[model samples]
Target: MVLSFLALSACSRDFLDITPDGRTTLEEIFQDEKRTEAYLNRVYGSMPSYFWKYGFFDFLAPFSDEAYAYSGAALGWAAGMLTPTINPLHTPQERGKGVYHWGTFWAGIRDANVFLANVETANIPSPTNRERFRGEARLLRAFYFWELIKEYGPMPIVTEPFANDYDYTTLTRPTFEECVNFIASECDIVIGNSNLPMRITTEAERGRFTRAVAYAIKSQALLYNASPLWNPGNDKGRWTRAAEAAKQGVDALTAQGYALVGDYSNYFLSKTDISSAPGDRETIYEVHEPQIDPVFSIINSIPSKPGMFKVGATPTQELVDSYEMQATGEPVILGYQDEEHTQPIYNPASGYDPANPYVGRDPRFYATVWYNGAAYDNIGGEIHLMETYVGGADQLLVAPLGWAFTRTGYYLRKFIDPKLQSGQPEDTRWKKYRLAELYLNLAEAENEANGPTGLAYSAINTVRSRVHMPDLPQNLTQEQFRQRVRNERRVELAFEEQRFWDVRRWKILDQTDKLVTGMEITKEADHSFSYKRFVTEYRALWADKNLLMPIPLTDASIIPDFDLHQNPGY
Candidate 1:
């Protein structure tokens, strides 16, 4: 067999970093239980990192209209992604903008296959231990497959490691249904294994794959399978299936005492530990970073005046407008009488004040966005107002047209720890899947299966109640309810890498990605603020072809018959 191995690094203290003097044999690895376990730990490291500072901070928000890339080089990927210029070979990876894990994930899949194929031979004393290890490998493999399908659509499923003489030319992409089935089957195998615990008990194995993780992945995959992109016939049966799967996952987690933790604003901040405390109950699965400072993520989003780089992704006015009025739970409807945006009209019922645009909005708006005159308590214990208006501090006009600053008169407040100091270590646990997302998934699936049922309302209301938002209207048509679910998901899951995929799956990308707008704030002579909503001139060109990312040109070139397998319009 042509076996490949990842060189284990000593950077992480949780996993063992075993270095062989030379090329190590499978016999040497499998004969020792610790070595076999180390191999699995390496696969765990491949889980995606949302905090890594590269191409627009690897945030999916900028690709959508949720935010805009202010930094020059970072803008390259965002700009390319929004236009037809984005080709397979010149993706975010080539531009040094974001972490494209298409290749990296495939390698992890190969490692998982190798471990599963040879794990039984390892010197594991207990049969239970062997089963748990095997189950963990299956879960990791399913996760990698889920990541692949989400990015590149249908993929060739390789369960066993290929032989040295295996032919690469014979490979062909599976049907989308087959890919989904393969992932579902892997999830079933992990869930059915009795040896796998519902949750990891040991602190040392805090982030290991568990039964809850398996169920969460299954729920997500099934939900995607029922989306418009995968279900072309608008199959009601697919929606029913998705609802059942999501409900099953949510019920299992809740039965295990999982629930929302803390307020909405504090849920994503750094936690002291991952123990099963009230504060940590919301996280289903997370990419845990231990005892390390999230400086890269924090510094990228912090204002330049706060003793750090100010260039980062800024929220757009379109996203700002999505936040509903706190008093009336209805979106503020704003209209411009002229192109200059000097004259503004607001929906009388929306209760939006042009003179004071940021007041009486959804509490999440204050928690997630840093707008003009928003106060922040600095690490040095000084409260400062974020002056994003023209000629004021953090101004867009002062910087040259391309310089890094707030282009939309707003900065991200979520996931940024106010207590962070220079050179101080801050640990952040990036929740990959949470209980709240499952609830949203269930609400969407139920509405599609059985339009605007009590089940759907209850599911969505659970999320709204967490932030103390009022419940959705009691009665509405199915279509109106659908819009409510979508808008709710957008507001609740903003900047957590959900909006980008949600828009695509919902098949509303063209409508949502049309034009990103910015709030042009000006300070009046009386120290009052004047807000003008103008198009940021950054428009995303979305077509049916953009539903699926193109297979990388490098991968296609090496294939014997690329034309048959390449995604349409690539």
Candidate 2:
């Protein structure tokens, strides 16, 4: 993998560094359709390869409602990290930037560009294959832009393959508008194409691109633009474009066979079971792999109760508390009885449960966060354990370790099947886009366009209904409705790799805390240290200029032009 990455990076130093060295010219490469499809397959795989490390700072990993984080782990690191929740920092795991994995994205982008340049002339025998190639390129291109917009803001929008003499190295970044408009327009073309599937008809063709993926991507981009975090630099047009694009994507995907999976949790669990149903009527778009083929895979997220990355919860506690209780339809915070605990108040009048932490919580929490006592059913049977890190020096104070981070206080169980352990690593693919996100996106777009329209309410209600949460107050405003949708997105999309970007675009980092400084009691009322029973408290832990990295201070010192022009606070 390291050699493969290095070889790819040797092609281009810009954006992602994964450019594989192929002696064939662009024209020569695309002449054969099979090669073209194989190249595009790598493009989809790149999303996961990039996303795996991306869980740290790729603008999607840390965007939860709980807390924010900081580190050079990624370019958009500051904006997404450092929110209100789990505030862990200065660990050995903080190299940031999802830096090394970027080679895969850039390499894949290079392939897309090289393949796209020759796509017009491809003599592929089937007309369907031809259109599919075009759609794949368009979708992958959109996917690349997804990274660009989140990381570099409005990066130079590159569509056509560039020449060696294009003088690409000296250019400054593109205007955010220019970049966004280009992405939005391309999605329009991709979404308009009719050759893709909303639901696959064959076993081998499961993870390919579809019209729904296009629409889902467009909605995501549009929502980012519409967000106040990116907007209010007078971005009305961006918001309108986002609304329109999302509407188009939604209308088109919904028209072609997308619907909701009745039990949102079942999608992940059932796929690992052969007896499980094959379709989620609600899935507008998704990326899947059943057998872990190298072409396109998501095995990184499929570890056991104790995973490889003994890292603790990547999810901030703030995100954990955002899910509304099914009965009350309100924020659910798991409080600590300790005086050091910072969870507002735990009284019924304060609106939360102190003893029954997991009861009546956000459905996604149970679905995503494997609490200390959460029981998960896998391929063979049930495994009762906590999703935390209880290894290393201070393992005494922590929970058990898992593949990624140790389950900080809670392990991420969302995409992982309760029945599928790392032992079996069940074939349930690390799913990308499903129907729930589409509904959330629609609610968001509608709320942005007209606040609390019936459309927005219905969209949000559909999602809440699945988990048994009641409808919102009838008189909510647009902003209020938008907040509801935003909160919904936070809980629903937790750990699925959308949080980081969501928080960045929402620009809520500065307004929230970025650490999980909860207090756990070691001493009881009798002044005896509680052995297995300790009290844990929650609060912001640190305040540092490090919130925004110094542009890889070392990189800036070497590159004169970058200078001390740091991001806002760093």
lDDT of 2 by residue, 263-361 (tens): 766666545222124456655444453342422223232222344433323444555556667667765543454433343443353245554456777
lDDT of 1 by residue, 121-153 (tens): 887778888888889899999999898888788
Measured against the true structure, the TM-scores of the candidates, in listed sequence, are: 0.89, 0.74
Alpha carbon lDDT of each predicted model: 0.72, 0.53
lDDT of 2: 0.53
RMSD of each: 4.4, 7.4
Task: Give me the candidate number with maximum TM-score.
Answer: 1
User: Where does model 1 exceed 4 Å of error?
Assistant: 1-8, 11-22, 56-58, 72-74, 81-98, 276-278, 290-297, 300-307, 334-348, 398-404, 422-425, 560-564
- Candidate 2, which segments miss by more than 4 Å at Cα? 1-23, 42-45, 50-103, 169-172, 234-237, 270-278, 288-316, 332-351, 376-408, 420-424, 519-570
Backbone atom clashes (below 3 Å) for every candidate: 1, 72
What 10-residue stretch in candidate 1 is worst by lDDT? 1-10
Pick out the ten consecutive residues of candidate 2 with the lowest summed lDDT: 1-10
